[model samples]
Target: MSALKESQHLKIPLKDIEIATNNFQHCIGIGGYGNVYKGELLIHGKSTIVAVKRLNEQFGQGLKEFLTEIQLLSGQNHPNLISLLGYCDEGKEKIIVYEYAANGSLDQYLRRGSNVPALTWMERLIICVDAARGLNHLHHEVGKHQTIIHRDIKSSNILIDNNWVAKISDLGLSKLGLSGLNRSAVISRVCGTPGYCEPEYFSTGIVTKESDVYSFGIVLFEVLCGKLCCTVDHDGFQLSATVVKDYYKKKKVSEIVDPILKEQMSSELIRDFSKIAYRCLHEDRDQRPPMTLVVKKLERLLAIQDVLLKAAESTLSDVIKPAHPLVREGGNASEIPLDISVLSNMRDFVKYNRLKQFALRALASTLDEDELWHLKDQFYAIDVDKNGAISLEEMRDAFAKDLPWKLKETRVLEILKAIDSNADGLVDFTDFVAATLNVYQLEGQDSERWQILSQAAFEKFDVDRDGYITPEDIRMHTGLKGSIDLLLKEADIDKDCKISLSDFCRLLGT
Candidate 1:
């Protein structure tokens, strides 16, 4: 037996398991190790559904493998990882219980003749990104000095939760990295499913984190092509081989993408996604990008797709009649022309909800006169040429020294464009004040003025209509130069890297 102690709290008595599972009346799935049954257990006076996997006594998993899974699951906690509720080990019976996934495994959806509804390109991308994040966490964030590799990372192992969140399940083949141990390659017996296994690991019986990356690449392509990794073509080439061959032949990405995605997916997105998958499938293990990089690239792709989707929506909205007045015409509000230029900027207007405006006012109220004066001085410092307005070069140069996170040139331009709302390519003191009003003092009597200022501030920072201010959103839309991590540390109460409206209000002592 392993030295790891069994978690008593997570140990469910076999009698309780049998009762919860109704004497194993509902077998939902069968795997190489056991049969999974749907069950319900009462906890803290409340009943919750769960998946109970009972090992087949005749040909079940060995004790060591069972222990390894228990040890791994007992300590692991992530939104994208399957949660182990408890386990049952009584006499000759061995079983494990997991938080039930309502939508089942991803493989069921990817199968050729499956009856499940087709997933859109965006949905597929989101699922893949979610799975990559989970795998990245496993491979890098397990402990301060330890890394874990999910040796079997295929479609069936990725379970979809009720909220469409993809969770990495089935850790039976996982290998934990020991501190100070050589992780260049693990000399283990050949394991993992065919087609998904890394070529190097298969031939040499050596495994590494890169092996998981290789398998993920196969899974990625399977998601893209809507076929299993092992599915063979008429000419006998496996799916991966066929796709790679077609890619080298300069076949258009649209031609290679699954037909179901043709209507909704853009060629640009397919091309970029295909490029990432191709790199992950590199024959040389060293050529495959790490999971962290994979996550980053996927996030960028998703962000781009989101922007494109929004642009398309905005365009469609323009063609349709306005459900509500496009411009609020009242005491001080002007009836702005509903032209193409104005329609194109609808994303900016949609971001300024009442809650965000209130939060901005609350934030502004926290600043004293001295702090407000200091902010003005800081803005003047950026107007280096002593001109009345700050140009893009001035903003970029100022941010280069002041910001903890480096801003790309495009991001700098985006920020400038957000602040310079007049389309004059210059940000005057008025624009500066409008953008940073959330950090300036607001007089008690200036309620109406504060409302206007708050609206401007809300529109300036909340670039996305997600009702939260993320560091990335700030970097893309704000001229404020500071450590984003430090900013998030101060304002993101949930530590989700985004400041919610309530959190923003709370941070301002409102």
Candidate 2:
């Protein structure tokens, strides 16, 4: 685009596209710009599979966009961003060819009741991270001084390759910010998908990286909740982002999310994942974290889930079998050794169900302060991020205000046994940790009352199965006063001392 000589190299002969597409006999998809066809083209000397988009001027105002796409993609190249191999500007025929996505667009799989297998929680997290990284490159690292804004960011535009790596595609609406990436630039007109676009960018003609952040946020929720942001009702009325925002703010998102997802993931992972997505939708764009920060948080979350999964598959006996009465640092007292089953379940943590959480709290209380304090340092040292998640200070503030409501993993006691070589009760943090469990195992001795039980992750880790979760049960389950208060307040919403599944799911956002 900058030089005619350089641009001419990307020109593909019309005959090649015709040969690749079998004379335009099979159409894979239809779009605003034109019809998308799947085909194979021989480049240099070898044949390569590709997706071909042919320009249909009478179909939509794509002439300008098509030229813009060729201009922009002609200069950009990244793994996460789609690659534009070449273009065909032979007379009236205008077409672009790029690598084919075997898995198709992400939206096809995200829609509910679809025939495609649902993506696991881990897969969704990875896809989001990939998409975020691509956007980050576009917003910050594309050129020495240039910043590009992806004017149209949505679920459908994200393509998943055969390996399931997400790729950001369709940048026809993208803009090259004349100003640096650090600042927002004014645009002549507002354009983008309605529900995915930000209010500020839509109302004012000012566009920034934050605008893409907003749209990406909506996509994140769509991935998490497994539903589109803008859904048409029977009356053709579209439910905007505000409705989703209201659902999140009210903690009623659990009712709308895929119950299977909530049931499969831990409450801690769900809360933390949702928190990042929610911040991106903040009314004040400045409050939204930069793409780099979002990438860090999301990657961290994904890592935590991966670790938790590995540990869940391991047993306490599989690792080190420490003797009972494990003394605390600088304090020696003969006490009952922690239940091995409880320790085993701790490894699984959020990988299975929230039941792991109940077992965690129960172990804390069953073992006196002396025993619990022994693992405090190891617990806080799970990651170098101080709290391994949202800032510890920010996390404490959230729990303080939304107490008993957002008692996140900050208090969940992520355990890895940090096994010290000195035979002392201490953690080393990087000792090749690995463990797992069936999660559905027998409990402690009959009279022991504190054994870990293999139960539901989302709910019902009924250590004491009278079919009800009471104050005594709560106190014994999770020892922290904050968690006890949050769970009790949330569970016993009727104040009748009864825990309602509905009320608890609302608080968990699972």
Candidate 3:
């Protein structure tokens, strides 16, 4: 028996499908295979919305495509891939159910329409990252023996959920890629949408994972240009051709970027994203990067974009003023004291006390608005050399007068190690702000916001996804080598040698 037959439990009754979909009353989408209807089902006593795709009667490749999709999607699962809830095959009727995506397809959002607003650069980056992760999983992480090539990868095939999470959909056109087999399968007829299809695949019926990479590159350009792959500008040039021409001709990023994004996005970010997209679109399939490398590049771009967004939203006044003035009215006004005010209110003190017990380096990475403002002058003062970053020597020299005793080189190194998240041996503005906020600003007054920030921070250190964090995990993420034991002991309320999410939240006084 095949894997599909073995997984019989995934089959849904025809009656159930009919009832869930209200007898196909609500048609939400139309695809080449069939019409997608919005449906609702009760599972675990909670209502869950789903998309039901009932195969079109007139569709020529009906049964073959349906079974192929079932075989492929049922065996694989990834956060970025559309989950195959179940399927129904009753006599001549066939239907497949999927998790409902509230935001619908990316193509809808990318194209200009009165119903949808233009997607911001951050949203586009996030959606692209999500899609890239799905493709990477399909190409590399599916299994050692098998690779799946999404033959018809296009903007319309990528669905966006309510939370802006993009899921790759439509596996009917996917081809199973068996490694070591030189000729996986040769198709007599060329498949896939034009413009996004790999040129080599069209010329020669040879399809590989690189083919998907080519489609993904087109999607990237679509995201950047906010135009379709086949779309030709007033000058009669395709989107890809126009972008490449503009890039090589030394056109400014503002010239190539979507007009809507030009004002909001930084030039450097646009250039970097364009370079990656261009590399993916390389004529030589061998020169194109694998999905793993593509994912890494997108992740880096996302990080830089995040920092730029945060910095843009912040100003100096947002930093909380210290209760005791850091600068005196004397000639040494340039020197700002480093002492953070201890909360006198019992509630606030309790919050601070709990927060101080954990390794705060990870939490420090996400500084609130006030913290960002507070670090501006402090960062400038500490970065005495004005080298754009604070080295160990600069840090120690800045605190030389504040310490009762002489600052030790080892102590300065410890400070640097804690805030230098990238292990670059220096603290940048973001790291500096995060460290200062983690040390001084985090308190019980804004318990709700602090809770959210602290939880995110906890998740950052809890790398294993076991809902509990250990000393080793803390040490690995925060570079708190010797201090992990102390943190574990303080935060590990149940003494299980691990910190549960609840324990972590409580420890932050949230």
Which model is ahead, 1 or 2, in terms of lDDT? 1
Weakest ten-residue segment in model 1 by summed lDDT: 333-342
- Cα RMSD for predicted model 3: 15.1
List the global CA lDDT of all models. 0.69, 0.64, 0.72
- Return the top candidate by lDDT: 3
Q: Summarize candidate 1's per-residue lDDT along 74-166 as a digit string, tens digits.
A: 898999999988887888888889999999999898887779987888888899999999999888889987888788999999999999999
Candidates' TM-scores? Answer: 0.63, 0.64, 0.64
List the candidate numbers ranked by TM-score, top first: 3, 2, 1
Off by over 4 Å in 2: 1-5, 178-181, 232-239, 316-510
* Model 3 lDDT per residue over 351-428, tens place: 333234233545666656565544566677677777779887887775443333234666557667766667788888
Worst 10 residues of 2 by lDDT: 432-441
Candidate 2: Cα lDDT at 499: 60
Clashing pairs in 3: 318-370
